[model samples]
Target chain A: MKVLSRLLQIREASILLFIFLFVGCIGIVNPAFTSGDSLGLILKSSMILLVLAVGQSFVLLTANIDVSVGSTMGLSAAVCGILLSHGVSGYLAVGAALVIGLCIGAANGLGVSFFRIPSIIMTLGTLGIVRGYMLFYTEGRWIEDIPHYFKELSAAAFLGIQLPVWIGGIAAVLAFIFLSRFSVGRYFYAVGDNEAGARLIGLPVRFITVLAFTFSGLSASIAACLFVMNIGFVPNQTGSGIELQVIAAAVLGGVSLSGGQGSLFGAALGAIFLEVINHSLVFLKVPAYWNNAISGFLLLLIVTGDSRFQLWLKGNGKKKKQEQEDMNRSKLPKSGEDGYEDKVVL
Target chain B: MKIKWFYRWEFFLLLLFIVEIAIFGWISPGFLHVNNLLFSMNDFMFISIAAIPMTLVIISGGIDVSIGSIMGLCSIILGVSWSHGVNVWLAVIIAIFCGLAAGLFNGLIILYSRVQPLVVTLGSMFLFSGLALVISGGSKASGYEGISGFPDAFVQLGNGSFLGVPNPVWFLFVMTAAFCTLLHFMKYGRSVYLVGINSKAALYSGLRIKWISLSTYILSGLGGGLSGILLTSYFSSARADLGSEAVLPVITAVVLGGTSIIGGRGSIAGTVLASIVIGFMQYGLQAIGLTSEQASIVIGAMLILSVMARQSSFQKVMQWFRQRKSNSSDLMY
Candidate 1:
């Protein structure tokens, strides 16, 4: 009971509660929504986003952003897809994709950390460049010749769920543990929470930032692998606009974009929540066009409400402290009161 | 580091513009035609229009990524209203007001919530774009086809010209002048700079920092709305995806115009000139037979190179390299 209460006390617990309520409402409207098959499908569909959101959460933890994640995903997927089509071994193709992702991420990290360029601008520059390069390399054409074995990887189930889902779930769990229980993982929070303090305390702040982005890029590559396998093809616009969605998912999951807050589980849950919203829109028969608007509106609503709630909690704490101070004053001796009166008068 | 006369960015941009025209004209003589040069402004006037207000947003220490989607939303709003038999002019006004409300929403949420402007605007960007799609999908004109056949007066707003210049060019000039006056010749402009430089100091000095920051967002939304209308007029169609690809170039123009992304250091004149430079660069790229995707690579590179060149650290590094080279030469002597 104590453990349960402690879990409920977390900021993400509210989000978890909201998700349950939301799913319950949807289930009430459409019984199919609660079905194991549908729920599984939602989880499967959100796996890519879950991974991306986790990666994005790391960057957010470091108070930096990588808008190029989507483009990197597309480019890496393109490379993997093209290499696979050319009969390259799966390991080589996947390795190339991950390396490409790491290089792009390293470039973004170097520009922001070493060159002193703003993260947004540097990543935006990479977004354009990577996207353009992918388009050019693909000759503005889609790759639809993915091998059957590659596509089968997404189909292969472990414990009644797809391989990718299990991979994503395990990745999220590992990341959560890594970010929470590990000393190196804690450095991300320290760096973002107080860069100057971290530096003064002998932390390699720049290297940590670069590591955060590299992790983001690596995760994006993993997402790309899953994306290509599931779709069995790669389009030039494979990950266009997914950056916003991934960031939204991370921010929605209680990851503060301003840095030094949030967790991987929250981001995974946020990704699931977003997928549920998308899935439920179809189930509820709302026009598909309303999906983006609804998701965005809900994101705004939740963020605003969450911040207000924090502010209220803070105010409540201050008031409690003030009342305690008053009570202590009332219990003070008369001579101490005379000293306080003299100080006030002075 | 002292900047040489040749290193004055705005002046250099002007020179670059002239050189661009000369080179493009030499490659394709028809590119130099007065009508071609003037009318080409129509293609990117929306970027110029949007960048003008963006200059202020960046100057006020905030960013609005939603203007692109807001542009699309406002355009769809005007189109949907007009398609429903409302007067075109009235629909335009309604659309502009909607932009104002969106901006107000952004400003209010950012101020009270104390969330980073980047994250707030990022969310709003998605919201506005999604709203645009919803509005369009609900309207009679659905799917890939856009609403068209606007009244002549409304169409004239985008295409009509006076003194042999396109209406968009005129609109761009007028808006630039108005924003320039508001930013350079007014106290409100000073407050914006002060707030950006140090919000706490500005607050202590009796400035309504919130209002000034909020007003910049409102102005940005106004620009987005106006650009949407102009785009619809120019193309004679209104689509939900109008200006969807605009955020990058608009920001690039502002940043290239010498506006510090970190805020408090920028100029209206710089933004205007930078917009023209970028607009012409795109046109000239296509004129030289490069694809738009290819052109974007150049634009992206330009954005990074320009900003990096402007960094104080970059200058220090360059000075260090030069000093090292001189020291080596002295050893040789």
Candidate 2:
């Protein structure tokens, strides 16, 4: 009974329902969309998105965002792919991608944690700097000719499931334990829920903040390696603007953008749902232009849903009170009432 | 830093702009021609126009990442409408209205839901851009080609000069003065600052916080619409992807111009100078032997550099955190 009730929880349940509804609607319109092959296709394509969203959940849990993830993914894929094509061993190529991820993640973490620039602005700036660096180094060309073995590895499956799927599944389970059962995991929620109080209680708030960002970067790099291994080529615009999609996926999965809430499972599921939507567009033969708008519309819808999820979790007695409280206390950063410089954290 | 010098970031930016120009002229003598400067100024009127209202939004402690996507949507509306034989001015009017509606939509959702501005606008950015692509007629022009064949008079809005100055520069000047008055001199502006500085205090002061917050977003949308109109006329075409690249520079101008990203403090004068500084720096870099790509990279480097200099603002952030902690236990929501 407990397991059944947990499975039926509103946030994840609603997302699950939407995925079915969307797929069913498309499946009815086009009989081919319901085929077993198409189902397999959606699952396989969602693997990369699932990977990236899992990565993003760590940072979001800490009450920060990483707009630079897309750039990090791009840089990782480019460097790894380029190295592979240049006759470097595949192991070294993967290692280089992880190193690139670590460096960018550390830089982003330092800027946000120590320098005190808002994560959004700092990451935005770094996005440009990293992209510009990539552009200058690559000189506006695509990185191609990745070894055939790399793509084959991604394609190979253990016991009928693809390799990437296994990777995502294993990562998801491990992340759930790490976030829910670990002290460091709880530290994220504590800091984001109340930053000053968290500091007063003697938490290494700075270290956790930076570590959260580094994890985000590290995830993007792993996703990058997956992407390069799967695609066999890294285009200049690879992962461009994908940060938005990744964030949307996490938010849809029930990860709160204001931070200190949600789960990696929800994030990974959200990524799956998004990829399913992206594939649905293709299956429905919808114009490519509508893709962005539809996903964006769904983002809004899901945000509304997430807030309702929050409300539902708050209990029935406080629903009205909480609703009223939300209206009164929404504008949080301005609490100083005097200092003109005070800003919103989340 | 004192409030007086904290208030002087824009002035410092202006000094930096002048220095950039002089350095460019020294590096390349041909860079100082009057015509080149005016024409260069024309390209950035859209940014300046957009940044004016963006200043107000940031001052109100909100950010509108969707504004660039709004510009794209409005331009497509103008392009598709004009192509289908709607009167040119009517198309523009319709586009601006649509843009205004989009902005209001952004405002409405954020106000009623109590969601953060960042999450709301980030979602809207994708939605608006997708809508632009949908309206652009996938079968006809596709996404990249956009829609052209606007009226000659409409085209002239972008290309024509007024009193020996380009239309965009004129647009920039007029819009700057208008925004300055609306944001700094008016009662509504004070309400905006009050709401941003402390909504609880604003409530006690008998201010309408929701309306002020909503209106700032609407103003931001209007600014985006105006820029869309200018960009369409200037490019003589409209693309779904138009203005996508300019989002960063617009935000850079607002923040680098001295507006606190946290809200409650900024000036139209600061945004204007920052706009000019960005335009000047881009052109100046190009003149002194930099590719457009290289200049863009430099601009990116400069964004990080400028933001890093504002380390003073974070101290107040800690105080704000304490206030939140004290209030959190008592506040049920």
Candidate 3:
């Protein structure tokens, strides 16, 4: 009973268990679903999404979102590709990408924090503006013929895993540690939990808000780099409309849309879960077009369930408190007049 | 009456409008011609028309980003229905109803499920776009070829002039007047304002907040449907991509008109005038040898600058300057 109750407390654990069950079901349908090569490919494809989800988790934890992450990723990739093609070293190109990402993220943060623009509106504007710049730079052309060294990084495996998987692993571990062990991480939770209170306590409210977006930008740039390496080319549509999937992943991983409680590990698991589900559909020979509809429906279900569960938990907590109060009152042995007065008070 | 005039943002917008027209007339003699102005106005009529109810939705503390897709969906429905020997009027009604259904679905999901409007609408944007693609098989519906046989009266609704003004422009005027009055004068309008300002307080005051929000989305759908119809007739072609470019312009017009994105404050008249401003800006820039893309950069910059200026701190600085000037004049006296 204690274990069952504990399981209910950790909502993300149940979601992870559900993902494993889904994998098992898919494996029964097609053994290829569980093969080493397929698993590796899934991990590689999910790496960029995983990174973006980590960033999204942070912003969403603070009751905000960064819809511009996908656009930032595209912009960064295009800048990196253009610079690399101009004979810039891969390292320099990567650095340039990070800078571009940081600038864009800072702009968004400033709009939201200083100018008092809502994060969604600010990010929505940047999403278009950045994408427009990318279109202008690329002239609607895909970037192919990347240097062999960059492509090799994506292709090479360390200890039977792709480079992207390793990168994802490191990101997940680092995010988990920062969120769990550091004062800054706790500050993020505190801000998300209650901004007014956090401010009253003299937290660097505006700076922390900006830092969340800066982290988001850095993660998006890193994700873009990984994407360029893995995909071997950058298309105009690269990362277009990917914000939805990343947000969906974070939400599905038990990140409350209302803000405050979530885990980076849960976000990573969410990305993996989505990838596995997509793979399962392909393995089951479902039409590719149906995937969008199915995934959208699943997201709606999960989000609705999370909200209902939160309400239920709150209701149960209230009810338990009431029961405890009732027991405490009943414990008093009373004379008739005293009992009558107690009943009137109740 | 005095209070009303002071509170209206439209007066300021109208001043801007007159100033722009005068400047453009001076810069380019052709801009003074009625035909040239009307032609330029016609280009953005779709966005102007859609912005009316979009203003209401945003003012009510929600957004309907799916209107672009809703317009596309309606156009396709109109095209398909017309090709099937359906009566044109009936086809239009059906098209409008289709848009309403889409909006209703968005409203239901957002209100009943308590999902964030941004996320729900974002998902529906893709859903509606995908549905349009599937229904049209990723091809243009070819309104020019398919709708050639539409009656003269129907076509005249888009092209024919009334009192020397284009019919669509006149239609825009009528709708703008109706919406502006409805939003500013009616009891329902007051409720919508209250709901947008503080939904919890509105609920406590006995307003059916959900229904109010739901109705705003429905109004947005109706507006999108009207735009879809006009676009179908004007372009003489209905395609799945018809109005895809209108989303940014619509949002830009609203924000530029000083509508708060966090909701509760907006004006229909301001939006209408802002749309005209944008229309003129697009035309003026194009006249000066800027491509559509470059024009977009100018519009984006203007939006950012306008938002920054609207921030309260900026207002305080201006007030301070005015106060300093007044104090110095007193010293001189």
Model 3 Cα lDDT, one tens digit per residue, B246-285: 7768988887787777678888888888899878887887
How good is the docking of model 1, as DockQ? 0.33
- What C-alpha lDDT do the candidate models reach, one value each? 0.85, 0.83, 0.78
- Steric clash pairs (candidate 3): none
Q: What's candidate 3's DockQ score?
A: 0.16
Cα lDDT for residue A306, candidate 3: 60
DockQ of 2: 0.35
Residue B296 displacement in candidate 2 (angstroms): 3.3
Model 3 misplaced stretches (Cα beyond 4 Å)? A1-11, A21-34, A139-141, A273-281, A284-286, A316-346, B1-32, B138-161, B244-246, B289-291, B317-333
Each candidate structure's count of clashing pairs: 0, 0, 0
Error of 2 at B140 (Å): 4.4
- Who is ahead in DockQ, 1 or 2? 2
- Best candidate, DockQ: 2
* Residue runs of model 1 more than 4 Å from their true location after superposition: A1-9, A322-346, B1-7, B312-333
Off-target runs (Cα >4 Å) in candidate 2 are A1-10, A306-316, A319-344, B1-7, B138-140, B288-291, B312-333
